[model samples]
Target: MISGLLTGLSLIIAIGAQNAYVLKIGLHKKYVFPVCTICFLGDFLLIWCGVFGIGAIIQKFPIFLDTFRYGGAAFLFVYGLLSLKNFFKSSGSLVAGNTVSLPSLSKVLLTCLGFTFLNPHVYLDTMILLGSIASAYGEPGKYFFSMGACLGSFLWFYSLGYG
Candidate 1:
């Protein structure tokens, strides 16, 4: 369990599209709970799917991986362009007291989805790598390992989101 927790943390600690989005919205204090929930749930889904052999299934089709790669790249690119454009503009704070309105909840959630699922590397880490590691534990131990991993994911997302 400890090992799984460490492994999950090690994999997730790196800053990437998902984490960046979480941290950005967290700092801004906009839709933090929903964003964090989406991240944790996404991680939980991938981790469990990986433990159950989805990694092998996914690997069988390289085209699927390629599609996610290109699609994720495009997603990040567009987000970057939007950020750059907004940087020059005087969009007010997302805080409660601010006069400038927040973006629609639907749009923010959609962006969170892109950040969470569109990243192929996240699949590699959570599904493939973590799943492979858990399989080595065999039987019930694998379940324990997955539990620890899921707990780690839960902790990291909430901490980073609400910290």
Candidate 2:
């Protein structure tokens, strides 16, 4: 369980759409409850899909993963470029407006959801990665590992939302 917790934590800590959105919401403290709920539920669904063998099925499609890798990389690069552009354009020469806004709750929620669901890497990390790791354990170990994954999702999201 401890090992599982560590693995889950490490994965979730990495930059991703959900984490970015959670941090944005935390900074603005707007619609925090719903944002947290959506984030947690999204993680739960991904983790569950991973533990339940759905990940294995996904691995069969080599082309899909290849395509996803290129597309995801491009998206992240563009996002980074946009941030850099904003940073340069500002009079203070720094990026801002990273926080969530009360008026943009719906937009934020929808964007977060879309990013989470649309990104293939999300599945690659949570479902495929976690699934592969969990498969190494025996029955009891697998159960505990799954539990740890679930707990990690809740803990990370709750802390991120409130922090």
Candidate 3:
């Protein structure tokens, strides 16, 4: 359990679209609970895919991997530049007031889906890497590992949203 938890946390600690979005929503304090819940649920879904042998299908397609990798990298670089631009444009504190106007639940869900699906790393982490690792532990261990992964996602989004 401990190892599984650590593996899950460690795998997701690196910066990515979902994490960036979560942090953004957290700092903005807008639609926080829903946004965070979406993140957690998204993570859970992807982790399940990885743990359930779906990653093997993804692994078989080298061209797909390459395409996704390059595209995701481009998206990250652009997203980073945009963030930096936003940071530089505003003089006021990012923490000062709620800059993010809360949107409707539908919009929030769409945004979460966008944050999740627009990038490929989510698939890589949840399916390729986490799935591979979880499969190593057999059936019961796989479940434990998945539980840990789910918990990690929950904790991370909860912290990002509430902190």
Estimate candidate 2's RMSD in Å.
3.3
Q: Compared with the true structure, what per-residue lDDT tens digits does model 3 show for residues 1-163?
A: 5666788888777766687677767787777888888788888998898888886676686777777777777777787797789789877554626564646768767867767765787877787788888889997999898898888878878887788
Error of 3 at 75 (Å): 2.4
Error of 1 at 35 (Å): 0.9
Looking at model 1, the pairs that clash are none
1-163: candidate 2 lDDT, tens digit per residue: 7777788888888867668767767776677788888877887788778878885566686766667677766666766787689667765521234432245767777866756665767777778888778878977787688778778878988898787
Where in model 1 is the C-alpha error above 4 Å? 90-101
**Positional deviation of residue 12's Cα in model 2 after best superposition, in angstroms:** 1.3
* Model 2 bad stretches (over 4 Å): 91-103
Q: Deviation in angstroms for 41 in model 1? A: 0.5
| Ranking of candidates on lDDT, top first | 1, 3, 2
For each candidate, give its TM-score against the true structure. Answer: 0.88, 0.77, 0.81
Which segments of model 3 are wrong by more than 4 Å? 15-17, 96-109
Best by TM-score: 1
Which pairs of residues have clashing backbones in candidate 3? Answer: none
Q: Where is the poorest 10-residue window by lDDT in model 1?
A: 93-102
Please list the C-alpha lDDT of all candidates, in the order they appear. Answer: 0.87, 0.73, 0.78
